[model samples]
Target: MRSKEIVIRDVEKTFQTRGGAVQALSKVNLNIEPLSFVSVVGPSGCGKSTLMNLLAGLDTPTGGVIEIGGERVSGAQEGNAVVFQRDLLLEWRTVIANILLPFELHGVTWLDRKDRTTNRQLAEDLLRMVGLEGFGDKYPFELSGGMRQRVSICRALIQRPTLLMMDEPFGALDALTREQMMYDLLRLYDQYKCTVVFITHSIEEAVFLSDRVLVMSERPGSVVRDIKIQLERPRNLSTRMDARFLDCVKEIRGVFQSQGVLAEV
Candidate 1:
């Protein structure tokens, strides 16, 4: 049940807001295996994003320790990449440049001010993987919403990160775009097999992409359920229509309703 790729032990986080102290997470504990896709779901403001920030090392826990691959996550730890709801693309950079930016920042090509040969190839491969082939010269401003997000994902993947954490990365797209992105994401994920911790509000999305789904309670949040998804791999559009897939979605929704995070309609 535990693989030690990620370990969150008795974690707690508190913020001192203008209205005094506010607890975002409490006594959270988890163990994530390497190369597994896990999704976290809960109602809005249930500390889902807070938990992600903690794991990504953007913020430290007020208490407890979080270890990624045996190293404590005390600060912005290296070897992990995160994709948020916003694409966070640089408007001036070409799509290829944006994807290769991480290597550039690492001094692979910084001082020379020239893109490294190998880095450029890796960036190109990633672009092709996401079906953005031959569009590497395009700027972020030239792209549609989903295309921009695809570039963001390429940027994240170019690093070959030890962990990939995505927080509602497709939340802004139209329904059709979101579904297409999900399918593309899973294909890339299969090829890379990096450990993934995804955060989303949609139960169907969680069920579709995850090997396990973590359900959190309301604010001062902690995971209340860790539901394993029994659906087959390489999921397709038909997977959504499968009875087993629907059952997984329904089961996660049941957890939300039971926690009073949602009301029966």
Candidate 2:
């Protein structure tokens, strides 16, 4: 088997809220293999976002360990990139500039690297890959919600990260746009073969994008089920109509139903 890209062992997190100590995560254990697409789904306030934060090393766990690429993560590493719910693009920078922001912020002088020219080409290529090629000269405000989010995705990939951590990256778009972005993201994943840990609340989105769907429980969130998605690759809108696709959706819905999260609708 391929080596694990990310490993979380018996992890626990607690917060000292105004109400007192609130348990956020308890005994969370997961091993994500290299280049696998994994989606995490759960009810609201289930610490799903917190889990992403932990993996990004933005926050430390109250207990337990997190290892990425065989090294213990103490802080954000270049190997990993995160795209949040919001685009979080700098308004002052142009599209290409925004995409190169990470390298710039890290004081990585592009001129010094042997692959500097190739890296610059890759940045432009990524923007194009997300369908933002011609708009590289435009500002973030000049773009629409979906467009800006696409730029964010390009920025995240410019680093050529080994792992991508996405927390509802497409949550703000319209239904049609969300579906398009899902396929776009899957295309990028296939091309780069990068490990992805996506956090989303949409059951259909989760089933469509993941190699495995991890169903999480409410507060003090814990994994309730880890369902493998055996669907064929290059999945698109048509895949949603497949019987196997519906089965996967129903299985996830059943988990949510058991937790009283899914209502008859």
Candidate 3:
């Protein structure tokens, strides 16, 4: 369970559509320390996803550089995995099969029987790690949204990624399920020592799960504030009640407040 660091320097991105030359990011510079959990929050169309895609190597930056573990990202790297807001699980496959799909697709098992055996055991171990023990035999359609998301997280981890990039992965669920998913995510992050770059809209979620929170401006987005979350780890629901936790949330909201995007903190 090795973790990797990410470095982004002077990153900029632009889109050429009928509107012509839409700048999404400007001079974005960030360094995600190894094995740390970092969250990015901002208003809609703020390029949070754009930055994430660049880090995941799903897209290329128009300018500057993005590196993972000291190596430049040219395209989708083998050691990086991404989970989106949507579960995107294959309804036809059972949960365990879905978790192992990456290995089959990447032909990890074709390397040798040893890799196959190791990954199968890893998949089951990760399933139980997220509290999804016996549900592995069930299909995606048989699970609730939160349960499906739990499976998705396991699927991502089964690849043993060094960098796990998520784009608002929990935003679609109901409020209670979202909170439960947050707890599950924290536990998984602790267990898997991978660098996480999470994108979210909730100040509370950002403060609760992140070692640091990066706030972006409205448009042509860039990092406006990189606030360190000084709270203790192994955070549960009660952590939301901690004074420092509340202050961290408030501090991030205050950044939005100053931008006139939020009226209250």
TM-scores, all models, native as reference: 0.95, 0.94, 0.95
Which candidate wins on TM-score?
1
- Candidate 2, residues 1-265, lDDT tens digits: the string is 2234789999999999999999999999999888889999998899999999999999999999999878888888777899999999999999888988888888668677855566667788998888877888899999999999999998898877788999999889999999999999999998887889999999999999999999999998999999999998999879999999999999999998988887787
**35-135, model 3: which lDDT tens digit per residue?**
89999999989999999998888889999999877889999988788998999999999998899999889767576989878887888898888888888
TM-score of the candidate numbered 3? 0.95
Predictions: Cα RMSD each:
2.4, 2.1, 1.8
lDDT of each: 0.90, 0.90, 0.90
Ten residues in sequence with the least summed lDDT for candidate 3 = 106-115
Q: List the residue pairs that clash in candidate 1.
A: none
At residue 133, give the lDDT of candidate 2: 77
Residue lDDT tens for model 1, 125-182? 9989998999899899999999999999999989887789999999999999999999
Candidate 2 achieves a global lDDT of: 0.90
In model 2, what are the clashing residue pairs, if there are any?
none
TM-score pick, better of 1 and 3: 1
Clashes of each: 0, 0, 0
